[model samples]
Target: MSETNDSLAEEKELLKSVENAPASKKISTYAKLSGPGWLQGAITLGGGSLGGSLYLGIIGGTELLWLQPLMMIFGILMLSVIGYVTLSTGKKPFQAINEHINPVLGWGWLIAAMLANLVWAMPQFSL
Candidate 1:
């Protein structure tokens, strides 16, 4: 336990040193940029997905049978757009949009995403 605590304290000190280091001393660009893509995929695969499925099942009573395919199509379209943005500008979609697109469009996407997240939050919050 003492050794573990000492190791953690050492790590904390290392992190503090890194934080205080000059920008020129820092290594820029690592594997972590892939994190958002994995995180987005995980959200799609996990709670958002299960909840969307259950909500459709309960609310639409099988009439939403077509919605699964529709959602897939929509997802593909959105991802394609993201791909285009990335390929064209060598930047992530959010950054590409904010940098290249109209300011209004950038803000609009932010608002739309927030609203979508809010809607998704409703069922989880209620339960």
Candidate 2:
């Protein structure tokens, strides 16, 4: 939509202007533009994160403190790889999924994805 495009353009301009600003100004600008940061935080540190942390704490005590940081590093690396692939390939990933990595495997992947979505949506029913 034009509205979304306009806002994105405006945000890009604001980011460009603040690129070399003072640290405080840059931080404030970033904070202002990061409208979805809270949503991302919620997703990242939601119920699953709490449960995992509690389970790890009980099992490994302080010995597993490094695990989180290590996992975060790997996650970042994987995200970066995915981003690079997206940038390099104009093709969409789901297209391949729909086409079938051969029909049988494609159906398997599609079924798994559907089941994952079903499980993911289960918590929302409690609301």
Candidate 3:
């Protein structure tokens, strides 16, 4: 009975500590927890996004201010779907796409990603 009481006291203390933690600390903790996914997201935001944003701003000015956020929401949704599919199927994204979707679409996506990487790298290489 004493050991049970002690274990209960320890559990309550742990819960209290978690409850008292600052909101910002909790957010930062979660960010650290998702470090690998965050890094992948950062890497995904490359020259293609920069170029797209530049063109959108140039062509539409403030009139298209909603476009960027809307696109980001859509991108996030698509990424979530991909993540879910990969997790549920235990398959790589490309393999899942090729096997479950269309093989041509998967190959085309791979080629497009490769071409975009080369295009973004060209100016850096020249410099």
Candidate 4:
């Protein structure tokens, strides 16, 4: 009975300490919350990227290695902007883009993304 009481007290104290922990000190909290977005970004590097790299290598050879890095930098910048907008406003990207920017532009982006995915997936499926 005494051992059980002691364990319960220790558990309560641990819970209290966790509840009082500072936000900045909780790196795992941010990591857990942001993990899905990171996973999605990683998974997006699929057939399209492979195809692009193959074409770039064949056509431009080593000379165009700089272009791939440049494109990746731009892609990172774009994802950062989308993440900021989504997180800050607590809104989905397409809705936020349509509301704050232009609806036509938003729709255009969606259509273009869909087309690109289809184009990329087709070659992979054919293989």
Candidate 5:
């Protein structure tokens, strides 16, 4: 019993140390740590994923389990490309695009993305 309790305590301390160690290293190197949180929230809150989950729960049950895996694959592919572009240039995605390509093209893409998001927002609010 004492051995079990000691092992659990050691595991808890190891977990905390692992978590805090990365954060301390980032701070020491002046690296930004908040980007991952925003990236995670963006992926998790995407309309397609949420809609699929809701629709599956309402209509199809677990029969549509395959879609979730497909969505995750595509989402990771996109994020990987975005992260590569951002990291290679040390610029946010928007700035990198506008800097490498024409500002007009960059802004055009931004406007199109905004319009798509606006279309998505309408159904979200109605629901």
Candidate 6:
């Protein structure tokens, strides 16, 4: 749709403008411009909601319906715990994970996030 493309273009521009300032600024800019995308990605990307939903929704209608929401709740809880740990300790997530958890896990998380963003976002540019 024209509207979708227009919005995506605007958001791409906005994100580009804030790309290098700082992590906080980039997050604030995204929250300002595309709150829904941020929320959707935060919650659903925990288990590949978009693609999985499209495929799963096709075959699994009412059977085992409680599982998806259950997973989402657990995902949210996990993210909250991670946030609490990072904030209470006053260390960046990457730094905390590297120090407290495994450094390789921290790097893997970072790369996966970057790749996920790139995977979905690159299509908007072609539009």
* Local accuracy by lDDT, each model: 0.71, 0.67, 0.74, 0.74, 0.66, 0.72
Clashes of each: 0, 0, 0, 0, 0, 0
Tell me how candidate 6 scores on lDDT. Answer: 0.72
Model 5 lDDT tens row, 30-56: 334243666656645666657757877
Candidate 4 lDDT score relative to the true structure: 0.74
Model 1 lDDT per residue over 1-127, tens place: 5996796697677556667676654433222324487766756565666777888899998998899889779978877876898678877677888898766776787788788777764555543
Provide TM-scores for the models: 0.53, 0.54, 0.58, 0.61, 0.44, 0.44
Error of 3 at 35 (Å): 2.8
Deviation in angstroms for 23 in model 6?
Answer: 33
Model 3 residue runs over 4 Å out of place are 1-21, 46-52, 115-127
Best by TM-score: 4
lDDT of 3 at 82: 72
lDDT of 3 by residue, 48-98 (tens): 667767888999999998998997798688678778877667699889988
| Tens-digit lDDT track of model 6 for 9-93 | 9888987899788999987886797546577675445444555555566778777577668867975775676677686666989
Candidate 6 has a TM-score of: 0.44
Off by over 4 Å in 6: 1-54, 115-127
Candidate 2: pairs in clash: none
Candidate 4 vs. true structure, TM-score: 0.61
Candidate 5's C-alpha runs over 4 A off are 1-32, 36-52, 57-61, 92-123
RMSD vs true structure, all candidates: 12.9, 5.3, 8.5, 10.1, 12.9, 13.4
Per-residue lDDT over 37-113 for candidate 4, one digit per residue giving the tens place of the 0 to 100 score: 87676556766678878997999999998987897798788778777877666689999888887899779878977
lDDT digits (tens) for residues 1-127 of candidate 2: 5996798899999999998999999999988987886686565555666666678889999999899889779757754554455445544544543453355655665686578446543444444
